[model samples]
Target: MSNIFTEAEIAYLESQPLGRLATVGPGGRPHVAPVGVFYDPQADAVVVAGHAGSGFGGSRKFRDAQAHPEVAYVVDDLASLDPWQPRGIEIRGTAETFSDGGEELGARITGVMPFDAAWLRIRACRVLAWGIDGDSFELSARDVA
Candidate 1:
């Protein structure tokens, strides 16, 4: 498979520090949270971190991932200027949760999460990017990296 992100797409994604992460919850409900996100060019993944005791809902996202990895995350730029609108990204991928300490992935999350926060990181296994206006495209992690 090819990468889902282009040079411009990657740059755009990285430029945004906040995004709404969606995860399926009980009864197929969707839980969305605004999180600090970072894109790793080498890993070809988007990483999000949370505190160990953050909230039941946050942990639910991981459970949803374990139960069903199929997930979608949104990162968009919202502006109120001449452009009149902002661009956005919708990344669809298998979600994975890792808690082991000291690995590079863990460190990356630590860097982004609050100092007192424990880490629950979500790495984008696959990404599908689209423009809010209507244009859309998809890219695999490999290609994105």
Candidate 2:
């Protein structure tokens, strides 16, 4: 669902620079990789910029997402190891790839990947967040649709 991210969730996502993206690979296997992730409030979608290398278009995550569409993304951190506190959000959604003309969005990552044509746009279907909205031990979950 677009424009469904809560204020807390949006803040959490925007504050983080990296996230793990999980997608389906060959033979229905799951694959996950570290991505340059961002929260696009205007589009209401989480964007993964292929800023790791030059071959982002042929990347496994991109191909897998293209074939499967369904994906999960996570951005989290230990707020305090001493206090045993963890904070994070997990997003479940369908991904769509923009083959070209993503220079504006891709520009979010400067000097990396050189404004390439490959990127994944994930529109959330479900949201699960913790340690940022309610009791740290309680999960805040909802279906975006």
Candidate 3:
């Protein structure tokens, strides 16, 4: 894996606890899920982990990724209400669904829910970040190579 995110972007991602993952569902519809977010530098990808039960390896987003392979993830926050500020990062990429990582990485992912280690790994093809490069709330876009 290659590093496509900047230091600031990585820091911002790791600091955030949740993200929205959008996957292609049945009939080409969009299915979005609120997920526990983690930036795994070792994997060089954004890892979305959530609860999985005995009957399934993961949730709907995982199934959709396995079927469609393309997905989008966004992590955002209201930096301030006093002055009305927002900051966020959006990643569009190819997604992979996997099980059996929980034992090793469960400690790393965020969220209060208990997870079975199943995760959706996103290999970013393009990334757009806002309010991260500096104090300015401008946007920065990049293509991962």
Candidate 4:
């Protein structure tokens, strides 16, 4: 219904290149892994390139997302070690797997993977952010488009 990301949140997303993606696997198991991520402002979603894996046909994250679209992704950092200021955003959304020609990859993550990678696009349903706006935080449940 409204954009869950503020100007600062978007800036943070742009500044960060890595995030943790969490997904559910068989037997109700939770799987989380570090991944290269980029925020697609045009899509209003987080984009992650899928790496080819030996057993799963794609990365574990891709398979997990395919099986269970509901997932959570977080990108965070310690803004101040002494003051203990932790800044980050958690995105809860449904993931959609698709093929990409690698054109969407940005310079921030281009050297991290190969071209023609599969992609997981997470459309945000809820967003929670903290320390992104000088210690202010908020949660948005409406569709962010």
Candidate 5:
């Protein structure tokens, strides 16, 4: 599907790193963690990378993607708690695990985080975003909106 965000908004979110990643466990449980991401404009997808050794539920998510591809991620800029300074991005998608092209994927992911050479890939299906300021929260873009 085409992205809901304008290229400008997408570029803003992509400029920030450290997003919260959400995945499902084997038992259909939800999992969340902070992660670095690489956004590919060409594919209109976000790729997340993690080391095989990190063992922080990434493996399970990768495995789960094989059976169920649904997933979500959030990127928030909380550097300033000032309500008006809040800028965040939320992404929901069908994920696919790809390992055959580790080197290439790693290279792309590494551009986001230098230590991300050992992770697998999760391609985002949808993305939502909002910019919050002291006065109000405006929807920049979202699949649901």
Candidate 6:
């Protein structure tokens, strides 16, 4: 797929450290969590790092991604509280969990302590964005590639 993000979009993604990740559980229940993420320009993917083998096996998000590869992730913020201008990008894609190659995927985005973890790689298939322009509020959607 050609790069799904424009220059501005890429900058925005790199600027943001946290994103809401949506995944479906084995029973088809939706789960959302705020996760530390980074945009991997080389892979053209969003990477989320989580504790390795935390509770039963791994994290809920990791298990959920394994059960259901389809997921949605969003990063948004209010530019102006007075005017209530909100801007962000929503990414829909397939996720793959990696434990063997997660060491280099460490996230320092939030200044969180580093630890051994598994990484979730979200390969963008579709992207939707809104309110990127300073003065105009518009929504745009496009398929990757």
Clashing residue pairs, backbone N/CA/C < 3 A, model 4: 1-143
Judged by TM-score, which candidate is best? 2
lDDT of 2 by residue, 48-86 (tens): 766535667788998998999999999998778988889
Q: Report the C-alpha lDDT of model 1 over 44-96, residue by residue, as the tens digit.
A: 66766554445423466656766666667888775445655556777776666
lDDT of 6: 0.77
How far in Å is the alpha carbon of 80 misplaced in model 5? 3.3
lDDT of 4 at 51: 44
Per-residue alpha-carbon lDDT of model 3 for 111-134, expressed as tens digits?
344557676689999999888885
**Of the candidates shown, which would achieve the greatest lDDT relative to the real structure?**
2
lDDT of each: 0.59, 0.81, 0.80, 0.75, 0.60, 0.77
Cα RMSDs, all models: 5.1, 2.6, 2.8, 3.7, 4.0, 3.1
Instruction: Sort every candidate by lDDT, greatest first.
Output: 2, 3, 6, 4, 5, 1
Model 5 clash pairs are 50-119, 84-133, 84-134, 93-125
Q: TM-score for each prediction?
A: 0.67, 0.89, 0.85, 0.80, 0.71, 0.85
Report lDDT (Cα) of residue 118, candidate 3: 70
- Cα deviation at 91, candidate 4, in Å, is 0.2
| Candidate 6's TM-score | 0.85
Please give, for residues 42-142, the per-residue lDDT of candidate 6 as tens digits: 68888877543443127798889988999999999887899778999999999988765554445443334443556778999999888763342788888
Residue 63 shift from truth in candidate 5, angstroms: 1.8
Q: Give per-residue CA lDDT, model 4, range 1-145, as digits (tens).
A: 2266788888898888789999999878999999866777666678877543322236788889999999999999988888778888889999998755444453334445453446778888888788887673444334454
| TM-score for candidate 3, residues paired by index | 0.85
Off by over 4 Å in 3: 51-58, 108-114, 135-137
TM-score of 4: 0.80
Q: Provide backbone clash counts, one per model.
A: 5, 0, 0, 1, 4, 0
Error of 3 at 17 (Å): 1.2
